[model samples]
Target: MEMSREKVAVVTGANKGLGYEIVKALCRKTTASYLTARNEEKGRRRSRTARTRPQAEIPSAGHPPKVYQTDQTLIVNFFSLVDFCETISPLMRNGGCIVNVSSSSGHLSRIPSQRLRERLKDENLSLDELKVLMQGYLLAVKHSRDVEDGWGESPYVVSKVGVNAYTFILHRRLAPRDIRVNCVHPGYIRTDMTKGEGNVLPEQGADVVVQVALSDSRGQYVWHNGTPVPWCGDDPRIWIDGKV
Candidate 1:
């Protein structure tokens, strides 16, 4: 992997909250930084607030969206992050870093099933396999069997867990390129997800993101305070506050 010193970073879901703050901070430190929000108009507005807003494509964490939206959460939270990484990786003028905004709700214990947790934590897990697993979940959802099938009622939580798992797979895949891929739980920020109720501020969460972007680390799972945490199975109480 040919590493370059140029500070080029890409942040998704940056239309508001922590993602927005991360892009803002990166602009001050990096030669080039881009903010991508799914809403084009919203992305443009956020970009204008940054010192070096560079135009680029955009991409969310989650909420218990409408019934139809549960599936969309998985698409945006898990698949979009992976797709965006694949799309932008080759275009990186300088070796880059991918920071996925995950949540404590993603912790393995939140899964509640040993079988599913084991499969998710499989070291040999592939992106295709993960997709298949998620497809099954969606199917179960469509049939109103996801809960009985042990996939859990909250698609939002399952989606982030998928992101955590993908973080590991992506880290290994991108290692050869020296382009780090890491996931961070930005604590419970006062974002829309929390309905403006949270212990951590938006910028405090963004601090973790900015640190990871500038570091040499690869494929790490961390908390908002920069503390390293296990990305896989462990005590749920260790991270999850009370489930999202």
Candidate 2:
């Protein structure tokens, strides 16, 4: 995949933090990228109005000037991803990549509450049903900003777990189509998400994304940088012994 031709990519929650940094890296490595933030107005306000901001110029500094309105719910996230795939996938270059920026907080082990565990494990539930259930989860988070409530530390963390599950689902959905879909736990990067408290820098976290995007591997779940993030339970690996 050479750099000149149009190569479209999408990064959700990208107006700031790791998502923004991932877009910055993708822009430099690819031809074009759709940076999706829940707040499109904020995206537009913060992004340069020059009609063309160099990919390298992303992550300049400070909060993005524009913020668009979006529902901070699991349903919205899933629909947006599906809509982007349906609308944009056709125009992308052959080696285009989809990087779902997730976090370690999404793990089942991270959710200590048995009730939450039972809810997430109900496989008979459809995606739509899961989305509905997820609302309750988000509400729980809002009620208690503390992890002790079984909501993790933040709503974003819970959503990322959904994103990780979505990544696996997308990998299956796109596998036969030959499009690459993968997720990465970019680590706790020092950014707005962690309020700049993380030890890792955004650029450092981005290194993991670059590795996944550049590698021939497809439909894989990798953790910080290029290491394979172990699959939970009986879910089979996206890749065969060594191949996808």
lDDT of 1 by residue, 1-244 (tens): 9766666666788877788778777776754777787789978977886643333332234444345777788888888877887787787643577788888877777776779989999989998998898888888888888888887889888899999888888888878878788888888888776666788878788888888878877878877668777766564444444433
RMSD in Å for all candidates: 4.8, 8.3
lDDT score of residue 157 within candidate 2 = 49
In TM-score terms, which candidate is top? 1
TM-score of 2: 0.62
Q: What is candidate 2's CA lDDT for residue 63?
A: 43
Model 2 agreement with the true structure over 125-239: per-residue lDDT tens digits: 4456656656666555555533665755545545666666556666666677677887777767887545567978877888898678767667666767477755453222233
lDDT values for all models: 0.77, 0.60
By summed lDDT, the worst window of 10 consecutive residues in model 1 runs over 52-61
Clashing pairs in 1: none
* Candidate 1 error regions (>4 Å): 1-5, 51-66, 93-95, 236-244
